[model samples]
Target: MTSDNKDRLGSKLHDVEAAREDQWARQRDADLLEKMRERMSKTACPHCKQFLVAKSEAGVPLHVCPAGHGAWIDAPALKAVLKEQK
Candidate 1:
């Protein structure tokens, strides 16, 4: 093939890879939002009366009160947080 044709093919491949990466990232974000919504639907902060936001602390998914009331950490998450402190 000619050099020009090869360059065009390379550019097209790069564009396809970029588009794939963008789509993957968007899907990942959507999945995370859905998970957060599910968690929020099941629990709420007593002090603030608002849905808790999902946050990662010490590599654990912890439900955090947006109003700064506090956070809800599960048993494994609590253990991870405590271990990080020490």
Candidate 2:
């Protein structure tokens, strides 16, 4: 094949790779947004009145305040934390 043909093929391959990367990035961003929405729907902090973010500590699910206020752990999670201490 001629040099010009090889150059065109290379450019086409590069464009295809860039398009694939862009698609993957968009999918990742969409997944992150869905996770954030789920977390926001969980509950809000009582003290700070802001939406709590879901977190796991020592295999316990906890809703933590984003404003440095406090965390909300369910009865089961609280029991788990207490058990871990002993």
Candidate 3:
């Protein structure tokens, strides 16, 4: 293969690897957050046993517990961030 082609291939592979790593990191973080949320919700919220329910108020998705003590995960935050687009 030509040097230019090899360089392009290497760059593309690097980009793909970077993207995949980023996705994996975000997923791992999400999993951790979910576990933490469940533990917190079970101890904090009276309504939710070990999970926070997603609710929407005017389009902003919120991960709120029954007792109203929970955190916003990445998806919920993304939804909130997109609120301005709507």
TM per candidate? 0.50, 0.47, 0.50
TM-score of 1: 0.50
TM-score of 2: 0.47
Q: Which stretches of candidate 3 lie over 4 Å from their true place?
A: 44-86
| Number of the top-ranking candidate, with lDDT as the measure | 1
lDDT tens digits by residue: candidate 1, 1-86:
99999999999999999999999999998997687669665797998788888887766777889999998877765787788889
Model 1 score (lDDT): 0.84
lDDT agreement with native, every candidate? 0.84, 0.80, 0.69
The positional error of residue 73 in candidate 3, measured at the CA in angstroms, is: 15
lDDT of 2: 0.80
Clashes of each: 0, 0, 0
Tens-place lDDT digits, model 3, residues 1-86 = 99999999999999999999999999998997677556545543444564666565565545676566664545656876778679
lDDT of candidate 2 over 7-73, digit per residue (tens): 9999999999999999999999789657655855567777867888877777666678899798777
Backbone clash tally (model 3): 0
**Worst window of 10 by summed lDDT in candidate 1:** 33-42
Model 1, position 13, has a per-residue lDDT of 100
lDDT of 2 at 55: 74
Instruction: Give residue 68's lDDT in candidate 3 (0 to 100).
Output: 65
